[model samples]
Structures are given as structure tokens and as C-alpha cells.
Target: MSALPAVIDGRDKRKNPMNIFAQIRELITTTLDTMVQDGTLPDGLNFDPITAEPPRDAAHGDMATNAAMVLAKPAGMKPRDIADALAAKLTSDARITSAEVAGPGFLNLRLAPSVWQAVAKTVLDEGTAFGRGTVGNGLKVNVEYVSANPTGPLHVGHTRGAVFGDALASLLDFAGFDVTREYYINDGGAQVDVLARSVYLRYQEAHGQEVAFPDGTYPGDYLIEVGEALKAKVGDDYLDKGEQYWLEDVRTFATEKMMDLIRSDLKALGVEMDVFYSEKSLYGTGLIEAALKDLKDKGLIYEGVLEPPKGKKPEDWEPREQTLFRSTDHGDDVDRPVMKSDGGWTYFAPDIAYHYDKVQRGFDLLIDVFGADHGGYVKRMKAAVSALSDGKVPLDIKLTQLVKLFKNGEPFKMSKRAGTFVTLRDVVDQVGPDVTRFVMLTRKNDAMLDFDFDKVLEQSRENPVFYVQYAHARVASVLRKAADAGIATDDATLAAADLSLLDHDSELLLLRKLAEWPRLVETAARTNEPHRVAFYLYELAGDFHGLWNKGNEVTSLRFIQEGDPATSQAKIALARATAIVIAAGLGILGVNPAEEMR
Candidate 1:
């Protein structure tokens, strides 16, 4: 479950062996080139814009190309005339059953049934390699996510970002990108200072002294054990010491415990980060000074006085000279202050240094996943990245919105142990990691998700996670039945079957949906969206379920035909191919395909 897809090399465009859409696109391009060489059209025509896409209405054809409309203006001819000529050329190919010119010169193509049958065979032959794409070109990408402050346990918000970022990294890997999943620990922030004080009170209570948890302190029961552990290690050593005497040691010890708790929580949800970057390492190490020096040398840093913010100006809004970064020059709404008037760094200073370190790591692209409340940080961070990298690296910031939990159609109660927000471990313990991962990706990162506990566990069509898993399980059951009936249904045998027998419309529809996988993988990777993979798997499961239901009414539509092993072999090949795609898609989402639904 942890292994990523293999990277694909080589950029030869001579008919992709596994991608049906790319194969047809290549065929169309070659035909157009032949037309130009024969002087049927004009010379030096650009074919980059010629696209092959499925028609909005499937009744029009299996696939439709806008080659005529795209090339007509450049070739100095009417679209209909170009479409008519292209139709004649395409009709000569054995795979194309029909190529008709429709309104506005759309070239609608219907392929022979054998073309789709070949797609099923290809899926069996390639297995998980069926939808792998080479679009990323093996470029290095750094995805920083779930950098929750080391103050307490992770809530539901951080859980969503963790799932989304991990899936997106896997999706990018599937598309051939070398991805590094990273987490930047905010251990140097003021929040960690608060955490040290909170643990100090707990440590006092461990020594049989009653301590009151005031408004600014964390009161969760999780820290009670940390207090007891501190008492066990060094009893009363810093009981009455001054703040400076114990602040550093307490902060270091508390931050380590909190990070250990976070790691355990993330592991419960099946997340493993490759790197955990500490913010405290940036201070007194010349990193922040070096980053600011880089900006100062570029003439992007200056002393300035900022005007009061809109709608919320401070009562004492006196103007003071502060060191600011010229974020406006890099497309921010306003310049941002990096150093305060007191000669100390603001919060933005450390963030700028962090991104500068990432840029120096030689990554081609950077992606930051933050919670929705950090919406204001998006522009400033992007501007900093653009300025720091000199516009050489692209940064994409994904903000995951809130998650509302439900159980039995009612809002879930907060964990007593967590005291405020529900802990990620609470959710994972209630429902396993597979359901959590799948439901988290059912919506885009920007959209809110309502995670219904009971619905996800229900064995019905309305539950997409259950529905998809059932489809794969159903295929397993069918294979078992075929084996019991003394039929050889291995991949080698299925691949060599006479797939020409699979000409029914229901069978061909399943093949068409399977053909869209490679294209879908490339599109999802290009857009940095992993939700598309979940959606595709749900739709594919529906197509497979529909074909399975059709067998109830049509005797010939059943996958295991009685007294006809040849027909059964052809039909079972489609079923096996569908399962292979479902398994591959679930793998990208970091979920193991369920062999049985219980």
C-alpha cells in the first residue's frame, strides 16, 4: 500500500500501447500528416490544436475530433470541406467503422468493436501499469502538508489536509513526478511557549499540588500523562526555578512529546511523511539572516510605515518605521512587514526563511497545504515564493476547508480526551483508515465535507466507498465461481481469449469507461487534484454494477455462461479488467482494495 507507481520514461509518440484515446489521437495526427505530404491540403499546417474528445452525446459516436474546425482557418478552407476529406481518409483504416462529418465540421468516429476489445486485453497485460502517464517528466516536487504546530493532538482539519496532500503526492507519483512528502514542524512559534506553560502546570499537579488550568492553558487529559512522566524522570528539580531557568528545557521536552503524539495519530490514518522539518533549526543558524540578506541585496526589502488595515484599524495606530518585504512587486495586494519596529522578526520572517530553504533544495515545484483559515496567507506566500525563486519555481497552495462529522445522522460529539475538537485518532478508531481516506477525497480540497460514519459503513449503493469496494469483491467472487466450474480464467488465458465475441453494447460501454483511465490520470495529475481519481472509481464501479444487473434479464449477458466456456472466458476478461482498474485507482488513494465486504 505504501509503494508508489513506477516512473515512466521515453517520449516517443508512435501510438501509446495502453491508452486508447492517445492511440486514436496519434492515428489522427499521422493521417493529417499524410494528407499534407500528398498535397491534399496545404503545407506547414499546425496540428497541435487538433483534439480528440468524446462527444457530449454518446449517441453521436464513440469519439469526436475537432480537427477540421481547428485547422480550417489556417488551411484556408471551410470546416466541412476539411472534415469531408478527413472522413474519407479515416474510413480507409480497419479500426474505424464509420467517420461522419456532422454540423460545424465535427468528425464523429465509431470504432470497430475489436478496438475496444483490445483495450480490455491491454488492461490485463499491464495491470497497475495501465494508467501510468509520463507527463511529469521525472521532475522533483516538494509537497509540504500537515505542518500543525506541536502544541496538542491533531484535530479534524489537519486530518483532511494530511489525506489530501498524501493522495495528491501519490497521484503525482503515478504521473511520473518524483515527489517528496514533507511536514514543517512549527516548534519555534509562540504556541509552543504556551504548550510549555500548560505542561508545567500538569507537572506540578503530578507532584500532588492542585493546579488551576486558566483560560490560556491547555486542559486536555492527554497532558496529564506527560506530567506524570516528567515527575518520574526529574522529580522537583525545577519546581521553584525562575522562568528562564526551565523554559528552554520544558519547551524542548513538551514539543518532542507533542510531535510523538502527532506521529502516532498520523500513523493511525496510514500517513507517513518523508521529512519533518523543524522551525527551531532556522533560528541562530544564519538561515533567517541569509534569507533576508538575499531579499535586501535584490532591493526588495526596505524600511516603511504601513497604513492601518481596512475595517479593523488599531486604536493606537501610530506610524513606525519597520522593515518590509516588497511583496506587491510579486503580485501581492500590499507589501508585507518582515521585521517589527522593536527590531524583532514578525511571524512572516520565519515563513519567508522556510520557503527560501525549500527553494535552495532545488525542487522544480512547491506545494503548501494549509487549513482554510489561512486564506490570507495564500497570496503573501505565493509572492514570497515567486520572489525567492526568482520566478523559477511554481508554488501551488491548497486550502482544505472544514469537515463536519456525523454518526447515525447526528453531529458527532467531541472526544472527552481531546476536550475541544475531535481528535483524528478518535475518528480513525471509530471508522477504519480506508473509509476515512476515501470519504475525505470525495470532495475537492476547497469544498467542505460531511463525513457520515454510519453511511460509510452501510453496504448500499449510496455509499461510494462501499459501492466501489463491493465491485472489486464481486469480481473476486466471480473468479472463484469460474474456478469452481473448471474454467481456466488466469490472466494469460483471459488475454488470449477471442475478445471479438464481446460485441454487446453493455460490454462495449464498460470498455469505453476503462479506456478513459489513462487520460483521467494525466488530467488529475496536471491539475494537482486527487478527487478525480475517487470520482472515476465510483463511476467505473457503477458501470460494472450496471452490466452485472443486466445479466439478470439477458441470459447471454452473464459473465459465466453454462456449457459455453469460450463465451464465458471473453465475458470474464472484461470483469477482470474492471477489477484491475478499480484496484489501481484505490491504490492511488492509499486504500487497499477490499477482497470481501463484511
Candidate 2:
């Protein structure tokens, strides 16, 4: 007999009722539409400007939207006049208690307390899926990230990009997109040529020859072991046969070893990709020519002379006609070259072809994760995708900034001479993958992260990684305590409890934040920023901590209520929701939610 599938095994499309904020926002939009239909306003109305964002002040209630101000200019009326009419239509909603027209014609929606309570119930009901959003609309997405050069071990800077990209891909997957994580191997560049020469030097040393570092060769000692492995495999066949006999074989062997090191590095960081696309594959397969030809078919590829660069123009400059893509036709600052003067395809050629391949693969959306040094390449890359896809597929590129490592009040410089280059394995071995991944994503991708090796290891409140994990463990501790007291603490029992018994302001605030999970998911997924997930989890943890602190002063606020199993279950329901949301957020960040802190 076949086994029954788990609840999550089946692809069930769960439906959720509109929270008060959503219901009120819908009311405001519908009212504006009705006004247009009645000829009280313009017939064609654009609702993009009407956004129902959470108000900063709690007294203003759940959400606020600018429906009135949006229609004011279009309807040939004052914002206040439009606001009054919109307010009248908005209060008509049963979900919203009062729709007050406030400063600058903004509509402030005051939802009932029951509404916020309902949001908590939604979190409990959906559990980890509570924040799942449908904004992706089942669009296929190809997220290319951590395409680091296969030359050496990954450092802290590479770790940040790896974590960010993995989380971003998971966020898109959870948000209802068919997502594929991809890595583009930079194996066909001059840097790899340098890597080959470096590996050869190491190979000679493996054959017992003394060697000194060259100016352009990779100085890192990683290639030394790779060299030894090659010598063992081929058995001195090319020891004195010169460059022609051994160069290609050594390059291929060295490249594979480097890639193996990189794959191990990514695995240490909990990053796994569905595709590992080789840049060399685009070279001999006529793929680059085809991508360039596709651009030429539309007059985008042409012979052109580039304008002199902004900061420096060589005195020996002579205008050379070369094949360039008309990237300026889209939004690039300048047209870019597809081929160099020597007739070899430039680095950008294979990149354009890779993106073209992605578009051909039926992906509706494309995202690339690059380091901040690639900022100059963003505009041209986006222009290429726009022109190639005919504006059909959208490309969003996220640039991760540098990670500044500090230890003992000094900047930690990883010197290869000291043989102290911190590999991904070194970081994982020191602090484990969960700590490494969490600390890497604690900051915004575009913001510089100060990752102190010492600070991250401290088991204190300042470390957000530990703080958030502690909240989840605290919930588990509460459940254990309740079970010890002979109270039912399972999810089914807790979920079935009457949640209306949870009435404290602190308790309700945590629920309110829990309710925002769905909205936050949609925002993060649409923007392709998973760092927002980490920030949201931190804030949610802050709320949980506040509730825990309140319990110290107010004993009734505790999840365990003496002599009241029903009341205890009700309070535990709120804690369960908190744990579930924390788990969901950690899942997106590729960090495990701790069941108990040890």
C-alpha cells in the first residue's frame, strides 16, 4: 500500500481571509473606483499611488493609504476634497472602525482590536506558511549568484554574497515563483590564465623545484596542494615537456581542483545551486556569436568608436572602430564592446550570451548577485537583458558590499604569507554554519558589514544571531515546562485553544508583527532583497524579548498560567506563532531555528 503524504507534501493552495489592513485597503480602492464610475471623478484612474502602508504611530491604527492624494491631481480637485469623499467610502468597510482624513489628504485606517487579534490567529493557523505570498504569480525565476572565480578558497566577503543569494532564492521560492539557483563559473577569463600559471609553478615545486612568486601569478598557497594532486595523477609525464605538451592538461586539471574547492566552500555555507554554468561552454559552441547576432538583427550591434573614459584618457589614444552593442539605446551611460581590438570576444560577450540563454530557457525573471566592485557593469548588463529579451523578462541585480573583519580592536588582514587566509571551512569550523550564515546576513547587502570574529562568538544580547535563536528556544522551553506541568503543549492542542484569552498589549504587539509576515514576504520577494528577512526577524525577536521581560513584572503575562490549562494554552498559542515565524524566517536565510540553546 502506498504511504499517505504529509500535509506539506501535497501542493495545496491555501486560502487566507484578508486581514483588516488588506480589507481596508481594498475598501479604499473600491470606493475610488465607484466614484469614477459615478462620474464624480475622472473615468480612468491610476491606483499605483494609493499604498496602504503601516502607520508609524500606533494610535493611528493598523494601516494608512494615500488614495485621496493620488486622485486629487487627476480629478482636478483639492486633495482634501478628494480625501473627504474617499474617507466616506472607506468607513463604509466593516473591517475598518474609522477612516480619518489626516495630514496631506492621507487616509488613516483604524481597525478594531479584533483585527490585530485575527492577524495572530492567521499566523497560528498557517504556521510556517503564514507569511507565504502570491506576488510571484508562478513566474519562473533564474537567480545567478556567488559566481566567484575558481582560483582560491572563499573568504568572508564571498561568504556574504553566498548567504544573501541563497536566502534571496529561497524567499522567491516561498513567494510562489518557480525558482532556479545558478552559478556562473568564471573559467574562461584571463584571471583563470593567471591561475594556470600559478598552478604550474606549484606543479614544479611538487617536482622539487624552488620557485618564487611572480607579480601576476596568484600568491595564495591553495594551488600548492592542487599541484601535488596533479603530479600524483599524471606521474611526471610533462615534467620537462615544455608548455605546449602540458599547459592544456595542467589547466584542465587545475581548474577542476579549484572548482572542487569552491563547491566545498559553498557547501560549508549551506549554499547549493541547481546549475553550475561554465563560461567556457559559451566559447566554442557558437553561443556567443548567436547572442551577438541576435543583437545585430535589431541594429543594436555595430562598428563604433567609444568616447574617452571620464577620469582618464591616454595621450596615445587613437579612435579604433570595434564591434559594440548599442546599450545606450536602453539606459547604459555608454555603448559597450562585444569584441576587443585583437578580434577575441571580450568578457562581456559570454555574459550577454549567458543571459540570453537564461531568457531562452523560459525564465520570466532573472536576478544576478554581484559584488559592489561590479557596480559599473550593472547598467550595461541590465541594458543588454532589456534589449535581448525585448523587455519581456526583467533583470534585478543585487550588489553585496565588502565585509570588514575585525579582531582585538584591529582590522584583520588575511595574509597569504602567514598562510592565514580564512577559508569558508575555517569560519564554519570555528563557529558552525548556523552562526556563520546568520551573522553574514545581519546587515543589508548594500551596506558594509562589520563582522568581528570575536563579537560573533559572544553569547550575549548584542549578538542578533544568538538573540533571535534564543527566542525560538525560549518558546520551546515554555512548551517543555507546560508539558511537565501536565498541560497539553502540542500544536494541535495549542491551536485549538481560545486565542481571545491573549489580551496584553505586549502580546498583541508580537501578533501584529507576526501578521506583517505575508506583506514582508511580498515586499522582499518583489525587491529581490532577502536581507530584509533578517531585519524583520530581528524586530520580531525584539518583540518577543519585550514580552518575556514583561512577564518578569507581570506574572499573568507568562505563557504558563497557574491552575488554568485553558488560559495557559491560549498564551502558548501566541508563543507557538512566534516560534513558527522565526523558523520560517530562518529557513529563508538558510539558518536552522534552534529548538533549545545549549
Candidate 3:
């Protein structure tokens, strides 16, 4: 049987909730309250400190709590005295079979087998909504990621950030957060000028002129099409003109085409953004000036000279009075410049404006997914958001470390189209979107990931994507076999089965793992890390595979039992629930669960 076991009728589906962990936690809380009301424990106790979580050692019990230790000092009573009284009150519940106090004051409670069986039924009834929770309480959150410069195609690094950010958004949405995915285009930067110059050379080439690409100009083949499009629109009009005549028009045109290329790449990876904000808009629309005015009104903007950065000052570094933001007052290490000595706004000016816009959008939380190279920017970015929102809005910045790609034990070559880096298209086209997304999330966002093409595709235990997909496919096979044997295996029929038939140690262990889904989802969502979902899915798959292999040698443990419909349906119910959970988890990661392994 796959991890969870399920058995429920239509009425049971509407009445019974899915989270067994929460149920047991409530039971523990209610038992503690009863003890307080009966005068066995002291009154006016703050039960907020009480916790019900699975014990580190499974043999101790299914769930353990430190209620006795937490309340002993407050109530002026010995911990063991409180624990003894609490355990006696808890064992009266039919769901909890045993409650014991161990060590000093911990209470270990073992629930009945029926409770775990009910978890399985919940999975079958709820399907993919099995692990869904409401931890966000409908708070609005803005997740900005893959805001790569509009000058070029996204490389491997941006791909990791994209996958991580997209999946994290999905996980938050599942946890009931109002999530908005955004991308900030850096079209106002100097890099777009270089892109325009590079495209100008390609435009000359399209006009049948020999133009040389200099060291500063981009020489990527991607610009060839944009240049051709430009030549087609304005043929020979600015062919020999100076930089004044065509620089602005070419910059605007090339940035738009590059953004189109980026959008196509993201579409290939199945990532969609709710908003695409432009940096160029901030410059002309008084947005940056307004943000600086807000800071100036609060005494956060001033004219000051910054000290040379500690340990690593540029050789040309010199003190100059400039428009500065007092970021140091809001936890930044030092004051940051907002405008340069030449009366032009510094890069931080637009960034502050962008965050101010996000704050003005009324989001309760803001999250930025950046590359590891932006580590130094976290402090100032947080300070900017804090000063902009006056500490009412919170900003979380997650940095995705580097991803090194390999194929057949050697480094993957760079993409010719992108000039120096491998584009996201190269990775997705080779591995497909599902494998790419799952493998990208196998490691935490801050850890360096080694993505091996040959290894990820192999159908082995070492490949987490294959391993998890295989588990789902195995359950599909079980349903097929049950149907071929003239047995009904629909979810409604399986939910009505007698789940008490599943009593083996292996089956119960799988069920316990399945029961962790809701708790895990809430924790993952709170941390803003979708990699936890991938890790949990891999572990759940391992447990399911272990049970499937055990059934080969143990006759009654098999999902199908010939000539016994009742027994077979009961065991098949467990398998069906496991598939439902695996599918649900894959959905969170933006991966499609396989129906059958090829």
C-alpha cells in the first residue's frame, strides 16, 4: 500500500476533515483544558506554549508534548505531577490508546490504528486537496523573480531562480495566500544600451554591410533576428547615422524583442507571471522622484559623502557629496547613495521606487527571488522596504545559488545562441519541463546544485524524479489490475472499504508518513521554500516503494488478493490514497505525476 489509507462514504467526505495531526493536536489541547477545569491542574494557565508533535523516536509514541514542562513553573507545580494528571485525562479519548510520561515531563501519546486509517480515507476523498492548509489566512503576498535584464536570454542561473520562485508561489497559493507573481524588467540600465549597439551591428549586417562587433557590443546570435526586424521597419534610414539618431529607438526595439525571447523561454518552462513591471517607467513617470521625495520628507534622504567601503575600495573611489538615503538608520550597514554626483539617479533609486510601488499595492508581504550574487544587496533592500513602508510591510529575499550542468561526467557546453551562457531553452528542450523543474528543486535554493542530464533521466533510485513518478505509476498499475480482475476500484467504492483490514507494521508506517502532509505543507509555506515539498515527496515515494516491494514476498500484504473483494478493496484503498497525495505534491512542484512508467 502507498502511504495513506482511506475509507469514507459521501456523508463522511462532507463531515470528516483531512488533517489527522491537527485532530490529535486538538485532542491534546482539549484534554489539557479538561484537567484545568476539573481543578487537577492550576487555572489561568496559558496553553499557547503547549505543543503536539511526533516524537523523534517512533517507539516512544506517535505524538509527544511538553505541556507539563512548559506549565510547571507557571503553575508552581512539579512537572511530573502535571504530566501524570494530563496523561490520565488523555487516555479516556477513544482515539488515543496510550499516554505515558517519560524522562522529566514529556507526554508521549499513542493513538489507535483507526486514526491512521482515517487519514488514508481523507486522502482518497479530498484527492489533491489532502495536504492543502489555510496558514496564510488570505494575506496578500508579492513574489518577484526572474527579473533578468531585458538585454539577453535567461541563463542557467535564472532558470533555477525561475523554477524555485514559480514553485514557491504555487505552494503559497495552496496554503491559501493571495499570491502575485511579478517580474521587474531592467530596461533602463546601461546594459540595454550595449544590447542596442550590438543589435545595430546586426542591423548593418542585415543591410548587407560589413560591421565589426567590438569588445563592448553583444555578439550573440539572438540579436540577429531583432536586427533584421529593425532593418525591415526602417530600411537604410539610420544606416550611417551617428549614435544620436538611432540609439534610443534601437534600445527600445531590441529590449522588447529580447523580452519576447525571454517570455517564450518562460512559456517553454511553464512559468507565467501576473505582472511585468518596467524600470524605464520609473524614470519618466516621476516614480523614482516621488519615492525619493517620500524618503526626503521622512528625513531619510540627505546630501552626504559615504566612507570608502571597508577592505575593498575601488581604485577610483573618491568622496563626493551626493543625494543619499539614510539606510543605516534602518539596519543597513552603511548609508546608500540614491543619486550620483552628475545629478543622475543611482541604481538604488529605481529599486527603492519599485519596492515602494509594491508596498503601495497593499501586499502584506513581499518576497524577492534573486541569484546568490545578490547576497550583498539583501541588507540594503530590506532597509529600503522597511523605510518605505514604515515597518508595516515585510520583505523576504531568497537567493538561489549556482546550478552547474553536466552530461556524461563532463560539463555541458555553452549555448551558441546566447554567446557565453547556456540558455533556459537549452535545458528545457533537452530534459523537458517536468524533469527540469523537479531536479532544479531537489536542493535548497541557497545550496549549489549539480544538475546531471544522464543521471536525472535514468530510471533508478538515485533519480528522485524517476523514483517519485515510478511510485505513482505503480498505484496506477494496481488500479488497472484490480479492474481487470472484475473488481470495482473507483474512489467512492474504495473510500467505502473496511480500512481496519490494514494492520501490518509496514502499512501503518506508510500511513504515518502520509499523515505528515498537512503539517509539512504549512511549515514549507511559512518558510517560503518549495524544495521542502520536493524532499517530502521523495521520502513519501521511498516509503511507498518499500511497501510495494515487501508485498512481493508477503502474500496477504499485496494490494490485490484473489477471490476476496472485501479484503482486496481495503488494501487497494491505501494504494489509491498514496497516489492521490503523490499527485498533489507533484502539482505543487509544477510536475505532472506519471500514470505509468514506460
Instruction: Quantify all predictions' global Cα lDDT against the true fold.
Output: 0.89, 0.83, 0.88
Q: How high is the lDDT of residue 333 in model 2? A: 88
> How would you encode candidate 2's per-residue C-alpha lDDT over 213-248 as one tens digit per residue?
878888787888988888898878877777878877
Ten contiguous residues minimizing lDDT sum, candidate 1: 1-10
List all candidate RMSDs to the true structure.
3.5, 5.8, 5.2
Ranked candidates, highest lDDT first: 1, 3, 2
Candidate 3, residue 157: how far the Cα is off, in Å = 0.1
Query: Candidate 2: lDDT of 26?
Result: 60
lDDT tens readout by residue for model 3, 1-598: 1101121101121111455766766776777788878887778888766777889899999999888999999999999999898888788889889999999899999989999988888888888888787766678889999999997788899999999999999999987788999999999989999999999999999999998887777888888988899999999997999999999999999998999999998999999999999999888898888888998999999899989888997999988999899999998999999898999888999999999999999998899999999999999998999899998788889999999889897977575444657888888989999999999999999999999889989999999999999999999999999999998999989999999999998899889999988888877887788999999999999999999899889988999999999999989999999999899999989999999999
Runs in model 2 lying further than 4 Å from the true structure: 1-20, 31-48, 72-94, 313-318, 415-420
TM-score of each: 0.95, 0.91, 0.95
Colliding pairs, model 1: none
Candidate 3 stretches greater than 4 Å from native: 1-17, 412-420
Residue range 299-369, candidate 1, lDDT tens digits = 99999998878898789888889999999999899899999898888989999999999999988888999
